[model samples]
Target: MIARKFWVLALGILMIGFSSSVTAEVPEIGQKAPDFRLSTPDGHPVRLSEFTAKGTVVLVVLRGFPGYQCPYCQKQVHDFLLNGDKFAAAGAEVLLVYPGPPADLDQHAKEFLAKQNPLPANVHLVVDPDYAFTNQYGLRWDAPHETAYPSTFLIDGQGAVFFRKVSREHGDRTTAADVLGELERDKAAHAH
Candidate 1:
């Protein structure tokens, strides 16, 4: 019995270690943001590095079509849209990541955007097929009936992450006002 218990504990430990090793860590402030290319609904490829090359990038990972459209995600997107002018003035490009299975992903993205007004020129919605981008950024929720964890990252022109917020729950999301304030602070800090 003692030997059997020891083997079970060892197997459990090994499994835990393996799982932790596979999970990616969230990019910290001052770390270079991971570059990824995902397609817009109309098939244009959007690359993170390209956006960062021009100016600041607000990378938002939304809970996309997880059996149903997430209301919180909609509200968050709407909030950002309401602040479109401010974001544009700050020279920040908002990249909204809608992630799900490859099948019907674009259709779902369209459905999600249907309720909102047309996206501002500064905002771009990209699809993450089969959670590739989510896993790459360590934001995959990996639970039944769940999608990627809602996250927001602020990357400066240099491609370095200056701010980030990852929400484990659906409702607690970073607000547009919060991000705009961060942008102002970041700009002031850089000036000095």
Candidate 2:
């Protein structure tokens, strides 16, 4: 009976350790954005640090192919693309994350991009197979018919997030105009 109790205590401690290691906290404003590496749709490696030279980095986390291609995700991409010129004018780079299961994630991202070919120079489409980026940012939805909570953050050249929005629902999202306005404000704040 003593041996049995010892084994149970050991297992309990192990479970607690494992669970704590798996959890991550979402970054807040004025905190350095967590760094992660992912590949662009074309199979080229891209890192969050790579965009630091481009001024503000507008990070968009999509729901990915949760159960099917999300229409709201498509519309959000279009909204940003439609304002590509404005983003460029503000010297900002947009990184769109398409996250889902590891199988065929690249192909899924490619097909999604086909809807709006010729992405803007300032914009990049990256795939997060196996939810590495999503998990790191603590945005995983982990429910039936959902993959991740759509989110957006504005990271400055120094990699500090100045603005953040994570939507629990699909419809509400930050628009291009909203990000653009924040970029202008960020610029003004940095100038001083």
Candidate 1, residue 167: lDDT: 94
Cand. 2 Cα-lDDT: 0.91
Q: Model 2 off-target regions past 4 Å?
A: 1-22
Clash count of each predicted structure: 0, 0
Q: How accurate locally is residue 47 in candidate 2, as Cα lDDT from 0 to 100?
A: 91
What's the CA error at residue 113 for candidate 2, in Å? 1.1
Looking at model 2, report the run of 10 residues with the lowest lDDT sum: 19-28
lDDT of 2 by residue, 115-176 (tens): 78899999999999888888889999989878889999999889999999999999899999
| lDDT tens per residue, model 1, 145-174 | 898999999999999999999999999999
Give the winner by TM-score.
Answer: 2
